[model samples]
Target chain A: MTDAAAPTRPIILEAALDAPPDLVWRALTEPELMARWLGASDIEAKVGRCFTVRPDGPVGEAPIACEVLEAEPGRMLSYRWRATAPGEAAALDTVVTWVLEPTAEGGTRLRLVHDGFPVVLQGAIRGQGAGVSTMSAVRRRQAPDLRRRGDGRAKMSSGEVIKWAA
Target chain B: MDLFDFDEAILEADILRALADPTRRAVFEQLARREMSVSELKAGFSVSQPAISQHLAALRGAGLVAERREGRFAYYRAEPQGLAPLIDWIDRYRAFWPERIDRLKDVLKDIKP
Candidate 1:
């Protein structure tokens, strides 16, 4: 995320990856690959596929239902996120978008954004197992592609080098 | 950015901006343990009631703290919910660890003679 300060708009969480644009794009759009990393649960992403992400605790049964918004090839993908609560309102639905850009060194700069999370669910996002697990799922799926080092290792992969340059 | 900007939902930037201040953070810290009145907050600092009010206004605007008017007293307390997103957002970055380590592994693989 560009930390230059959007000044109260939306808090952007962004990261650059060392994978090719297509690989990065696939990890986001392909259902199987997505499940390997970050699916609220197991899901298939199509223009109009509906899926549920089940939480793992005494919180009863909360299935996170979602509909795919945009799934352009190698460019962008988005979805609608909402809790399938009995009295849930339409206005409460959130949107998540993923944008991929090809960098100079053939790596993809990936941006994963969740735009509709309410001020209330902040609890879910807090290092809670579900939210953290979801984010980890996404990162792990992209790990092979990103392959960039943070703790200073001697050998750097080609993609890692490209990521550093980006 | 908005105090809840990290949340993508709530579009209240003033609240985050208000909390971004050192004085505001201090005020929040004080209010965390218990509810206190406007005058009570003012007593802890050298600034005037007007300044404290100004700070409280921003905090109130951000939803970081909510005020209840009980009779003649306006009591302020921490809105723990307001702070959760920031905590979660920061924690998400920590998820980067596994990926970073995996990247290091790939680098190691490349260097193997």
Candidate 2:
């Protein structure tokens, strides 16, 4: 069984944009607009729609594969992103969620959460170690640890602090 | 080999893949408390003895755990240093997001109403 005490910690980023929620949403969801600000992407704002984001440079031309998980116009958006380098059989999958709240001053308060990384890693490790059958239980147990580790305060069974190496 | 010469992406991927299992994580955490032999570790989990050995092998492969034989029995302990690459990878995003947001702000300004 998974540990209940630890929860997956998402990478959160917040920004207050001097624009309305609809404007901010369009910038984030529109491929042309997103390419100008974020990266070159052909993403649509519909749940289950798959897309890709190809950024220019030495990072190679392998695009980031994405699938929209949630899409609420002018409010919230979430998607699963996977990056697979050429010649590698395995891909790193992560989830990115965006929450937009309209401010009293008419600006947009944007919060972004990138999650599922640690669990993905943990699932791979567990499958290799214990076999694939136990992955769900292991993932449930690992969620809390991922969340706890994100905040930089991971605790062991003995209550000893497990500090991340700098 | 110089540590700086290590390919971080490859190393980080390998490390993450190795420690991704819950059983291995528990084993690593158990070892973090104190070094233990295979039989001793087996007592803490409901899995078969062979399963524990498999978990240990993965942990060792990732360099997250180390083994030392004392006579017939081999004891394993957590090697915290092995986690450095994963931590570094996470830290990069922590630093990268703010700067990206600033760039986004500039992008927003250029957009017409």
Please identify model 2 stretches exceeding 4 Å from their true place: A1-7, A60-62, A86-91, A117-166, B1-10
Residues A22-138 of candidate 2: C-alpha lDDT, one tens digit per residue: 888888899988887667999999999999986544543357789999999999999987665455423345688889999999899888777654532342344254333333343
TM-score of 1: 0.41
List ranges where model 1 is wrong by over 4 Å: A1-9, A40-45, A54-61, A84-92, A119-166, B1-113
Give the TM-scores of the predictions, in the order they appear. Answer: 0.41, 0.72
Q: Write the per-residue lDDT of candidate 1 for residues B22-110, one digit (tens) a residue.
A: 66667776776567998888888888899888988887777778888989778997665555443343233234323433443344234
Supply candidate 2's per-residue lDDT for B93.
Answer: 46
Q: Per model, how many backbone clashes are there?
A: 9, 15
On DockQ, the candidate that comes out on top is: 2
Which candidate comes out best when scored by lDDT? 2
- For all predictions in the order shown, the interface RMSD in Å is 13.9, 11.4
What's the distance in Å from true for residue B104, model 1? 15
